[model samples]
Target: MGNITGFMEHQKVPLHYRDPMERIKDWNEIATLPTEEILREQASRCMDCAVPFCQDGTQLAGMTTGCPVYNLIPEWNDLVYKGRWKEAYHRLSRTNPFPEFTGRACPAPCEGGCVATLATDSVTIKNIERAIIDKAFEEGWVQPNIPKHRTGKKVAVIGSGPAGLACASVLNQHGHQVTVYERADRIGGLLTYGIPKTKIEQYVVDRRIRLMEEEGIAFVTNTEVGKQLQMDQLHSENDAVILCIGSTRPRDLNIPGRNQKGIHFAMDYLHQNTKSLLDSNFADEEFINAEGKDVIVIGGGDTATDCVTTAVRQNCKSLVQFDIYPIRPTKRAEDNPWPQYPVIHKVDTGQEEAKHVFGNDPRAFATTAQGFTSDKYGNITGVKSVNIKTKFNEKGEKIRDIVPGTEKIWSAQLVLLAIGFSGPETGLIKQTKVALNNQSNIKVKKDTFQTDEEGIFAAGDARTGASLIVWAIQEGKEAAMECHHYLMRNVS
Candidate 1:
C-alpha cells in the first residue's frame, strides 16, 4: 500500500471539466486531465485493501457496482502512485483493451463499489486509467498486437461498435483474420454517432482505429453485411460470423398530435449534428438547426442529457427537460447500502451548460408529456404536460399515475424524445437465419455466444439489450474465446 494513511489524509479531487459557458461554444471534449501530482494523490487514496470490492465487477441490486471488465484497480492505483506508468498501462491493458474509451465515457461504477467509499470518497480510478493510457500513447508505449502466425481462418464481425471491436480485437490477437463491418461511413457505430463529440473526441477514436488497422484487422465501413453484401455471401466467404450489432431501435412516444414536424428522435438529432460537424464543421447546414427555438427534451437518461447539450450549443432560445420520474435522493437511501451503485441526484454537464446560459436549472421533475400542441402547419408549438407520480399496479409493478388538475402547456418549438432504445433492429439480422427472443434480441446459448445456427454467434447489446459500454466489451471478449474454441476443435 502506498502510504497506508493516504485515504484518511487526502480528500477526493473531483474530475475537472471545461467551463460550461466556454465549452458550449464548440464541440470539443469537456473534460480536462489533471496534473501528474494531483492524479498520483488521487491514486494514493485507493486503500489497496485485502478484498478490494472496487474490482469485483458484478451486479448488486440489479445495477452494476464495479468495473464490468474486472480491471485491476488496486494494482494500477499503486503503480500510478509510485511513478510506474508503463507498468500501470500493462496491468490496465491486461483486462480492458481500450481504457481510453471507457475512461472518457463510462459512469465509473468502480468508484461506487470501492472499500474506501464506505467512509470516504472512492479513488479516481477512471481518471487515473485514462491518464495511464494517454501517457502510454504520448510515450509510444501503445502498439498493435500483431500475431506471429495466421490460422487462415476468417471471422466476420457485423458491427464496428465497442462490442464488435473488442471481439474482433481478441480474435485478431489469436491469429484469426478479423474483419469488422460497419454500416455507417465511419468505423465506430455508437462511439462515432450515438455519443456526442463533447464527451469523446473523434481523434481519440480515430487514433485507436489506426492502431487496430496496423494490427492487421480489416475494417469495412459504409457497407452493411446484409444489404450491400448479402448474408449468404458473408456466410459462404467467412468461416464464422459474429453479430455485435447494438440495440438501435429507438422507442417512440405515441401520443396525441405525435406526427408533428418539429419533434424528432434524440439519436437522429445527435447523429445529424455529428455527421455534419465532421463532414464540414456544420457549415453545410445539412443538420437540424435549433437556433432561436424553445427546446423541450423528453425522457430522463444519458441520451436526454446529450440532447440538452447539443441544443445548448445550437443557440436555442429556451431549454427545459421533462423527466417522468421524481428527482432522486441527494444521498443514498436506507435500502441502497454500501457497495451498491448509488441512485442519487447528479447535475450533468448538459444541465450545467443550460443553467449557465438560462440562469436556472432547466429540469422539470415528476413530469411527463401528455401530448403535443401543434400550429396550423402541423409543427410542434408546445407540449401538453401532466405531473405524474409513481404507483404500484395490481401485479406490484411500478406505473406512472397522473395527478389531477396538474396538466399544463409549455411553449416549445423543438421536441427531442430520448426515452431509450427498445432492442436491435431485426430486418437485416433475420436474413442470417438466427433466431431472436421475444424482446427482439438475438438468442444465444446459455454460456456460449453461439446462435441457433452453427458457426453463427452474437454478443453485446444485440444479444442482451441496450447496456453500458463496459458490459458490451466484457461480453465481446468472452464471446471471442468461445468462438476461438469452436474454430480450433478440429485442430491438434
Candidate 2:
C-alpha cells in the first residue's frame, strides 16, 4: 500500500448524478465527473490486500464477484496515487481493452469484491477507472498501439459487440490481420444500439472503434453474413471465422391481441427509437411514441428498466412494469450470505425516475400480462393482467397458474415486451451448419471456443446463450487464443 493509513482516513464517495426531475426531461448521461481531489482521495482508499479478491475474477454462489477481465486494480490505484496517470492508463488498458465502455455500463463487480467493503465502504474503483481513461483521452495518450509485425494470416469476426471487438483487439495486438463485420450501420452491437445514449454516449463507442480501425483492424458495416453476403463466401475468403452474433431472437408473448398495431418487442422498440433519433431526429419516420400515452412494459430486467426510462423521457402519461417473480428482499437473505451477488430489490435509474413522477414504484411483482386490449381501430388501448404463481407440472416443466379474482386492467396505448432472447437468429445458424447444444447455443467445449468445423470458432452470446457483457469479453479473449493456435498450426 502506498499510504498504509489511506484506507482508514478516506471514505467512499460516489460519482454525482443529475437531479432526476431535470435529467428525465432529456436523453443525456446522468453521471457527472467527480472533482480531481475527491477522485484522488478515493483512489487512495485501496487496501491492497494480500489476496486482492477485487481483481480475481471468480464465481461464488453462482455469481461473479470481481472484474471478469482481471484488471490490475492495485497497480493502477498506486500509479494514480503517485501522480503517474498515463502509466495508470497503460496498466488499466493492459487487461481491459475497452475500459470506457465498462466504466460506463458495467455493474462493477470489482467494487463488490473490494476488501474494504468487507467492513467499511468499497473503494471507488469504477470512478477511478473512468477518470484514468478520460484523462488519457484528454492528454492524447489513448492512441492505437498498432502491432509492429504482421502474422500474414487473416481472421474475420462476424459481430462487432463487446465480444467480437475484444477478440479482434487482442488478435490485432498479436499481429494478426482482423476484420470485424457488423450488420448494423455502426459498430459496437449492443453497446451502440441496445443500450441508450444516456447511459453510455454513442460517441464513446465511436471513438474506440475509430482507434481500433487506426490500429489496422478493418470494420465492414451494414453487411449481413447470411443474407446480404453469403456464408460460403465468408468461409472461402477468410482464414478463420469467429461468430459473435449474440442471442438476438427475442422471446415473444403469444396471446390474444398480440398482433395489435402498437404492441412491439422491447429490443425492436428500443432499437427503432435509437435509429430514428440518429437518422432524422424523428423527422421522417414514425416511432412507437410513448408521449402522452399510457405505456405498459412486460418483464423485469435491464431492458425493462430502459423502456421505463425511455418512455418517461417521451413524456408518457403513465407507465407500469410487470414482474412475474416475487419481490426481492432489501438485503441478502439468510440463505444467501456474503460474497454472493446480492439478489436484493433496488430501484434502478428508470424506476427511480418513474417513482419521482408517478408517486409510487411502477413495478408490480408477481404479476403478468394476460392479453392486450385494442381500440376500434386496432391500436393498443390497454393491457389485461393478473397475479400468477409458479408450480411444477407433471413433465417437470415450470408452469404459471393464474389466480382467480385477481384480474386487473391498466390503460396502455403501447405495450412493450421485454421478455429477453432465445438465441441467435436461425437463418445464419442453419446456413452455417454448425452444431448446437441442447440449449440451442453453439456447441463448444467448456474451455475451448472452437466449433465442429475446423478453422471456425464461436464466442459471446452466440456460444454461451444469453449472458453478461463481461462474460462475452472473456469468451472473446479465450476464443482468440484458440484461433491463434489454429492459425499457427496451419500457416507456413
Candidate 3:
C-alpha cells in the first residue's frame, strides 16, 4: 500500500452527477470526471487488508462478492497513489480488457467487499479505474498489441457483445486470426444499442472497436451466421467457432391487451432510440415517442431503470415502475454478512434523476399489472394493476395473491416491458444442433466450454443466462483458452 494511513486521512470522494435539468436535456454522460489529484487521493484510500476480498471474486449467498474479473485492486491503487498512471492502467488492463466499459456500466460489487466498508466508507474503486483507463487513452499510452507471428489458425466469434469481444480479443492476442460476426449493423451487441447513450457515450465503444480492428481482428457487421451464412460453411472456414451470442429473447408480458399498439419491449424502445440518435442526432422521425404520455415500466432492474430515465429525457407526462417483489431493506440483513454481496436497497443514477424530475420516487413495490385498457383505435390508454402479497403454500412454494378490492386503473399511453431475458434465442442453436440446458441456455461441459457438437463452444450469457459484463468477459477469456488449446492439439 502506498499510504498505510490513507484511509484514516481521507473520506470516500463520490462522483458527482451533472444537474438533472441540464443533463436530461441531452444524451451525454451525466457524470463529470474528477481531477487527477482528487482521483489519486481516492485511490490512496484502499486499505492494505490482510485478505483482499475486493479481488477475491467469490460467490457468497448466490451473489458475487467482489470483482468477477479479479482486478488487481491493491496494486493499481498503489500505482495511482504514486502518480504512476501508466502503470496503473497496465495493471488494470491485465485483468479487464475494457475497463472503460465496466467502469461506466458495472454495478461494482468490488466496493461491497472492500475492507474499509466494514467500519468506514469504501474506496472509490470504479471511479479510480475509469480515471486510469481514460488517462491511458489521453496520454497515448494505449496502443495495438499486434502479434509478431501468426499461428495460421482461424476462429469465428459469434456475436460482438462483451463476451464475444473479450473472446476475440484474447484469441487475437494469441496470434490466432479471429473474426467477429454481429447480426446488427453495429459492432457492440448491447453496448452499441441496448444501452442509452447517456450511460456510456458511443464514442467510448467506438474507440475500443477501432483498436481491436487495428490489432488484426476482423468484424463483419449486419451478418447473421445461421441465416446469412450457414453453420456448416462457418465450420468449414474457421478452425473453431465460439458462440458468445447473448441471451436477448426478452421476457414478454402474457396478458390480455398485450398485442395493443404503443406497447413495446424495453430493448426495442431503447434500441430504436439509440439508433435514431446516432443516425440523425434525434432529429428526423421520432423513435417511440414518450412525450406527454403516461409511461408504465414493468420490472425493477437496471433495464427498467433505464426505461424510466429515457422516458424522462423524452419529456414523458408521467412515469411509474412496478415491481412484483417487495422493496429490499435499506441496510444489509444479518444473514448477509461481511464479504457477502449485500442484498440491500440502492438508488441508481437513473432512479435518482427520476426523483429529481418527477416530485417523487417512481417505483411501486409489490405491485403487478393485471391488464390493459385500450382506446377506440386499440392503442393502450390505461393499465389495470393490483397490489399483491406473497404467501407460501403447503409445498413451500411461493405464490403471489392479489389483494381483494385493491384493483385500480392508471393512465398509461405507453407500456414498456423491462422484465429480464429467459435465455439466448434458439434459432442459431437449432440451426447448429447444439444441446441446450434445461433453462434453454447452451449446454457445455461441467468444467469446459465445449458444446456437444464438435468444433463449437459456448460462453458468456449464451451459456450462463444474463449476467454482468465482468462475468461475461471472464467466460469469454476462459473459453478462448480452451478453444486455443483445442486448436493447438488438433492441428492437421
Candidate 4:
C-alpha cells in the first residue's frame, strides 16, 4: 500500500509529449519522461482498494482489461512511492520480461481496469513501470542473467518478434541452448520492424538484444525457418521448435484500382521506414516517402494511426484517415462500464500530431474507401469513399448501410492500407504442414500450445492471429514453460 491519503491528494499527472511541431521536424521519441520526483508522486495514486484489478488482466466483452503480462502493478507502485526504484524494477520484472517495451508501447489496460478509475482517473501504472525499468538500466542494475548450468538441449525459435524473443529469453534462462532465427536481416522482429521508432527507439531494442546475446542466446538474422534453413533441420537439431512468425499476411483492399502503385500495406511501409532510419538514417531512400503528397490512410486502427504519425513526420502535404466504424463516445457508453476495458474515444499520438498540423482531426468516421483513382501512369491520384451507418440485424448480424449522398473523392498521391492482418503466412505453414484453425492461424492444442506435430509448438500471433504485444509476451512465457516440461520428458 502506498501513502493512505496520496490518491486523494494527487490527481493523475498527464504525460508530457513534445510539441507536435517540434516532433514532426525529427524522429526522436515524442513523449518526454517526467522527472523522478513527478513519477514518484504519480505512483502514489495507487489507492488501497479491496480488489486491485489492475494486476489481474482478463478479457471482458471481448476487450482486454488490466495487465496482460499480469504485472504486479500495485506492488511496484508502492515500491516506487517508497523510492525503492531497484526493488520496484525487480518486482516488475517478475511478471513482464520486457517492461521497457510494454512501458512505452502497451496501451496499458491496467489503467483502464484501475479501481481508482471507478471514482477518478487511474494511477499511472505504465509510466511508473517504465520509470523503474529505465532507472534500473541507468543505474546498471540490469545485467545479463546467464544461466550457469546447461540442459544440453536446444530450442530453435522462429521469428524475432516479441513472442519469439520472449520465448527465446525464457528458454535461454532455462539453460537450454537457444538459437533464435529471424527472417529479417536484424534481430528484434516486430520490436525492430513492426514498431515505429517514434514509439520504441531502436537503441532500446538493440540494448535488450545485446543483453540477450550476453546471456547466451544465439541470434541468427536473415534466416527464415523453412526456406534458407530446411524444416527438418530444426526438428533434427533442436529439442523443440517454436513458431512466432506473427500474423504478417495483411488483409488488403480488393476494390477498384487496387493495383495502384502508391498503395502499400501498413506493415511494409512501417518496416521499410524503421529499417531505413536505422540502417542509414533514411539516406538510402528505401522507405516509402510521404513528403509533399496527399496521403490517405485506409484504416483507423493502431496501425493506421502509426501510418498517420509516420506521414506527419515525413511532412505529407495533406492527410486523411478513414475509420469504417462510427466514432466512439468520449465517455463510456451505457453498454460499457468500469473494470472492463472502456471502449471510449481515444485520441492517440498519431491523431494528435495530425490534428496539430492539419488544423483538425484526420479521422473520417463511419467511412471507407470504395475504390482508388489513378493517373495515366497508374500511380494513385485519389480514393473514392462512402460514408455508411452500421446496424445490427434481427439475427444479431452487423451490417453497414451506405449513406447515398456521402460518396466523395479524396485527393491523394499515397495510400496506406492499415486495415489489419489475415494470419501467418502460408509458406512455412505449408512446408511444416501444421494444422490450422478456422481463422487460418496455426492450430494449437489447449494450454499446451503444441501443434499436431510433436516437438513443434506455436505462440503469439502465429497461434492466435493478430493480438496485443503484452498478450504475445505472456503467451511466449507460458509456451516456454510448457515447452520446458515437454523437453524434460526426453531429457532422461
Candidate 5:
C-alpha cells in the first residue's frame, strides 16, 4: 500500500504528450516524459481495494477486462510510489518480458479494472510501469545474463514477433539453445514493421533485440522458415518448434474496384512507409505519399486511427474513416458494470491528433465502403459508401443491413483498409500440414500449448485469433513452461 492518505490527497497525473501540430511534423513518440515527482504522485493514487481486479484478466460478455498478462499492478505501483524503481522494474519484467512495448501500445485493461476508477480516477499504472523500465535502461541495469548451464536441446522459433520473442527469451533463460527465424529483413516483426514509428520508435525494438542476442538467442533475419528454409530442416534441427508467426493475412474488401491501385491494406501501407522512412526521410520517398490527396480509411480500431493520423501527418487534403458498426456511447451502459471492459467510446491518441488538426473526429459511424473509382491508369479516384444498420438475428449473431438511398460517393485518391486479420497465412500451415480449428487458427489443447505434432507448440495470434499483445506474451510464457516439461520428459 502507498500513503494511507495519498489517494485522497493526490489525483491521478499521467504522462504528457506532444501537441498534435508539433507531433504531426515528424515521426516521434507522442508521450512526453513527465517528471518523476508527478509519476510518484500518480502511483500513490492506488487505493486499498480489498480485491484488486486489475490483474485478474477475464473474458466477460465476450469482452476481456483487466490486464491480460496478469501483471502485478498493485505491487509495482507500491514500488514506484516508494521510489523503488529497480524493484518495480523487476516485478514488471517478471510477468511481462517486454513492458516497454506494452507500456507504449497496449490498451491498458488494468486501468479499466482499477477500483479507484469506479469512484475516482484510476492510478496511472501504465505510465508508472513505462517510467520504471525506461529508468532501468538509463541506469544500464538491463543486461542479458545467459543461463549458466545449457540444456543442449535446441529449439527453433518460427517468428520474431512479440509472441516468438517472448517465448525465445524465456526458453533461452531456461538454458535452451534457441534460434529465432524471421522472414522479414530485420527482427521485431510487427514491433518493427507493422507498428509505425509514430507509435513506437524502432530503436526501442533494437535495444531489446541487442539484449536478446547478448543472452545467446540466435536471430536469423530475412529467413523465411517454410519458404527459404524447409520444415524438414527445422523438424530435425530443433528438439521443439514454437510457431508464433502471427495472424498476418488481412481481412480483404471483396467489393468492386478493390484491385485498383492506391487501395491497399493498412499493414502494407504502414510497412512500406516505415521502410521508406528508415531508408531515407519521408520527403525523399515518393511512394505512398498522402500529400494533397483525399484519404479514406476503412475500419474502427487502433489501426484505422493510425491510418487517419498518418494521413494527417502526410498532409492529405482531406481525410475520412468509415466504421461498419454504429458509434459507441461515451459512458458505460447500465448492463456493463464494474470489472467488465468499458466498451464506451474514448478518443485514442491518433484520433485526438486528427481532431486537433482536422477540427473534427474523422470517423464516420455506421458506414461501409461499397466500391472504389479509378482513373485510366488504375489509380484510385473516389470511394462509394453506404450507411448500414446492425441488429441481432434469432441465432443471436449480429448482422449488418445497408440502408436504402444512403449510398454516397467521396473523393478518395488514397484508400487504406484496416479491417483487421482473419488468421495466419496458410503457407506455413499448409506446408507443415498442421490441423486448424474451425476459425482457421492453429488447433492446440487448452492450457497445454501442444499441437497435434508432438514436441511442436503454438501460441499468440496463430493459436488464438487476432488478439491483444498482452495475451500473446502470456501465451508465449505458458507455452515455454509446457515445452520445458515436454522436453524434460524426453531426458528423464
Candidate 6:
C-alpha cells in the first residue's frame, strides 16, 4: 500500500487509442502509451485491498473474476507507483510468462474484480502492466534466463501458441530440453497469424521468440507432429509430450447457398491476410481482398470483431455483423452481480473502428444468418437473416427461436463465419489415439494433466476448448509442473 488513499486521490486514466480513421488505414497497433507521470498516478490508484480479489483468479458464477495466471497485481502496482519499474516487471513476470501478449489481447478480468471498481472505476492494471514491461524492455532489464544446469530431460511441445510457449518456457527454466513444434510456417501459432497485427504487432511476438531461442528452447516451424513427423517417432524421442495444439476446428454456419465462393472461415481470412501482410506487405495479392465489397461477419465475438475491423482496413464498401443472441443490457442484470465478469454490453475496438468508417455500429443483435443469396457466379451477393428471441427451457437451457415475419436480406459480397471453434482438429488426436471428452477435448484427470496415453499430456484449448490467453497460459504452466513431477518420479 504505497499510497493508502491513492484510490481516492486519483481517478482512473484510460489508455488512449490512435484516431480510428487513421489507424484503419494501416496495420499497426492502435493503443498509445500514457506518459510516465500519468502511468505512475494510475498505478497509485491501486488500493491494495486486504483480500485483493484482483489477483485471486477465482471462478464465480462460472466465469473468471480475476487474473487467471494469478498475477501479483497490487504488488506490481505499488512497485510501479514507487518508480521501481524493473522490480515491478520482475513481480509481474513471476506468474505471467508473456505480459506483452496478454497486455494487448486479454479482456483484463482483474479490473472487473478490482475493489476500486465497486465505488468508481478500477485502477488501470492492464496499462500499468504493459508499461512496466515496456519500460523493462527499454531499460535493457528484459533478458533470457538461461538455466544453470541441464536436467537432460527432453520435452516436446506441440503447438507454439501461448500455451505451448508458456509450457516450454517453464520446462526450459527448470533445465529441461524443450522443443516446440508449430505446424505453421512461423512460430507463435494464433499469436502470430490468427490475431491481426493491429492488436498485437508481429514484432512483439518475434521479440519473445528470439529471447526464448536464446534461452535454449528450440522452435521447429513448418513441422506438424501427426503428418511430417510421425506421432510415434515424437513419442519415442521425447521423454514427455505436451499437446498445446489449440482448438482449430471452426464452427460453421450450415444453411442454403453455403457453397458460395466469397464465404470463408474467419481464421482462413485472418490467417491469410496476416501471412501476406508479413510476407510482402500485401503487395503480392496472395490474401483475400475485401476492397469495395459488402462484408457480413457472422457470430459476434472477438473473432467476428477482428473480421469486421480487418474488412474495414481492406476498404470494404459496407459491413454488418450478426449476433444470434440478444444484446446484453448495458448494466449488469440481477443475476450478474459484481465480480462475475460483468455480462454487460460494451463496444470493442473493432466495432469502434467500424462505427468510425461505416457511420453506425455494425452489430445486429438477436439476428442470425438464415441463408446466403449468391450471384450467378456462385459468389455471395447477400445474406438472408431473421430476428430471434431467446427463451429458457424447463431444464434451464437457453433456446433461440426466430421471430416470424422478421426475415430480411442484407447485401453482402463477402461472408466470414466467426462463430467459434469446436475442438482440436481430429487428425492429430486420431493419430495419437488420445481419449477425448464429450466436448471433443482431450480428457485429463483433475489437477493431473496426463491424458489417456502414458507420458503424454494436454493443456490449453486442446483440453479446455476455446478460451482466453490468460487461461491458456495458466493451464500451460500447470501442465508443465505436473509433467515435470511425473518425469522426475517415473522417467528417471
Candidate 6 root-mean-square deviation in Å: 1.2
Q: What is candidate 3's local distance difference test score?
A: 0.91
For residues 290-315, could you state the per-residue lDDT of candidate 5 as single tens digits?
88999999999888888887788889
Among residues 3 or more apart in sequence or in different chains, the pairs in candidate 6 whose N, CA or C atoms overlap within 3 Å are none
lDDT of 2 by residue, 1-492 (tens): 787568899888898888989998777788888888888778889887878878877788667888889999999998888778999999998888888888888878888788887677788998999999999999999988999999998999999999999999989988999999999998999998898888888889999999999999999999999999888788888899999999998999988999988888898888878888778877866577898999999999889999998898888999999999878998778976656666789888899899999988999999999888898899889899999988778987889888999999899988999998888887877777688888888888666888877778999999888777877888789899889888888566
TM-score, candidate 4, is 0.98
**lDDT (Cα, 0-100) at 258 in candidate 4:** 97
Give one digit per residue, the lDDT tens place, for model 3 in 1-492: 989889999988898899988888999999877888899899889989998889868778678879989999999999999999999999999999999999988888899899998878889998988888999999999999998889999999999999999999999999999999999989998998888888899999999999999999999998999899888899999999999999999999888888889899999999988888998988866589899999999999889998988999999999999988888898878978888887888887777878888988899889999899998899999999999998889997889998999898989999999999999988888877688899988999888999999899999999999988889988899999999999999566
TM-score, per-candidate, Cα-based: 0.98, 0.95, 0.97, 0.98, 0.97, 0.98
What's the CA RMSD for each of the models?
A: 1.1, 2.2, 1.6, 1.1, 1.5, 1.2
Query: Which residue pairs in candidate 1 have backbone atoms (N, alpha carbon, C) closer than 3 angstroms, thus clashing?
Result: none
Write model 6 residue lDDT over 431-457, tens digit each, in one string.
Answer: 776889999889987657899899899
Q: Which ten residues in a row are the worst by lDDT in model 4?
A: 426-435
Q: Which candidate, 4 or 5, would have the higher TM-score against the true structure?
A: 4
| Whole-model lDDT per candidate | 0.92, 0.87, 0.91, 0.90, 0.87, 0.91
Over 155-221, each residue of candidate 1 has an lDDT whose tens digit, in order, gives 9999999999999999999999999999999988889998899999999999999999999999999
- Cα deviation at 299, candidate 6, in Å, is 1.1
